[model samples]
Every structure is written in C-alpha cells, then in structure tokens.
Target: AIFSVGVSQLNASLAHRIPAREENILPTFRKALDLAREDADRLCHWISQDVSEDDFINWVTGSVRRMWGKKGNREVQAQFESDEGRRSVFDMLINLAGYSMKTKDILKQCDRVVEGAVLMRSLLKKVSHN
Candidate 1:
C-alpha cells in the first residue's frame, strides 16, 4: 500500500524534465503516470467495498507486495520505504514539477498514492474470505 503511493509520487517527480534533456524518459513517465491513476481508482473501489481498517491495511500491503513481485520493478516497488526508495521518489517529483504542473495538485496527487494502497488492502481481504 505504502509502496504504490511512493511509486506514483516518484513517477510524478521523475517526469518534470523538459524533452531536450532526455526525451525518451518522458514517454515512460507518461505510461507510469497512467498506471498510477489506475491504481488510485482501484484504491477507491477497494475502500468502498470494505468495513474493517486492520483488514484493509493488510490487504493493501500484501496486494502491493504481490503485484510488485510479479511486475519485478524493484526501483518502483522500493518507493514505499527505505532511503534509496525516498530518493527515487524525490527525483521523480522534481522531474514532474519541472514540467509546469501545479505544485499543490501535484503534491495532493503524490499523497493520494495512499488511496490505491488502501484499496489494494480491501481487495485482498475480500479474496481471503472467499
């Protein structure tokens, strides 16, 4: 759960650069950002379906671990915790901000990464019961 939000925030940070510096990264960032938005939606859906906070937390944590496990994007996954994880997130945020997005909304977007994590937790709880 924490990790998903971190990656989304990192994706935002890494995307703020102008094309002249490294044009290739822009497209990757675009794809990454799209995925991040999807994650947030998933979070909202999970939250809507659930009733227990502890179950929700475990679900988000476990779901994120499983998803990242399959995807094998360690750098992306690490953003949920650790020093390097945070550094990467900061780098992405800097990049995104450079691209002229509103600072406040961007921060909110970064923070909103938690929403996906929350949703992931909810989904897992549902799965375990069935």
Candidate 2:
C-alpha cells in the first residue's frame, strides 16, 4: 500500500515537473511517462518480494538495458526535439534505480549513475524554464 502510494506520488511529480519542450510533443511525452511509471511500479513489486539477489540484479540489468535499447538516433530524432525530452527519458531510468537491491555494491553504483541523471534532469529543467 505504501509502495503503491509512493509510486503514484512519483508519477504525479514527474508528470507535473517534466514539461514537454515543444507544444506538439506533450501527448507523446505523457504516454511515455505513464509507461515509465508502470515499469517502476513493477520493479518495486519485485523488490518487495523475497527474490534472490541474482534475480534482482538480472531483472534490473535487463530492464535498464531494454530502456537503453529503445533509445537511439532514430528514436530520438523521431520522438524528441529537445534536451528536456531526453531528460524525461532519464527520469524514468532514475525511478527504476530507486529500487532496493539485495546486493548493495553493484546497485549502489547504479544508483550513483541514476543520481547523476536526476541531477541532469533538474539542471535541464532549470535551463528550459529560463
């Protein structure tokens, strides 16, 4: 219940904070944002369970990789027009990185990377607004 609420809060926060850089891009951005929230919820559920460390690591790796694979020159050209759009994608990745991992060292490193992304997203938001 708490986790669900947290996920909802994050979804609301991200949706509210991350604006589409262009007028025509808002709807597509919302769709992608929703998908990212759903993925985070799913990842949180896995964390709540008594899954093995290996399984948790594997799942997170695969999930992040899938996200990475979806991003590229072609998709970026087609889907995003500004750096804010790119920041939105990383926001989703950061949401995933908030998951609790059985193995601390590896996930800690991953979290560090996500933290950088989160910071970049914030910086980009500031720049976009200005």
Name model 1 segments beyond 4 Å from true.
1-3, 6-20, 50-128
What digit string (tens of lDDT, one per residue) describes model 1 on residues 1-130?
Answer: 4445636665556656534356766666676777778787876554344324444334435654454343323433343334331222223233223322333586665643554445434455454474
Question: Could you estimate the TM-score for every candidate?
Answer: 0.29, 0.23
Native-to-model Cα distance after best TM-score fit, residue 11 in candidate 2, in Å: 19
The TM-score obtained by model 2 is 0.23
Clashes of 1: 8
Candidate 2 residues 1-130, lDDT tens each? 2334444555565566666356635655566667667778876653343323343234334443344443322332332234332233243343434432323698666765664455434433433343
The CA root-mean-square deviation of candidate 2, after full C-alpha superposition on the true structure, stands at 19.0
Clashes of each: 8, 0
List per-prediction Cα lDDT, in the order shown: 0.46, 0.44
Off by over 4 Å in 2: 1-23, 51-130
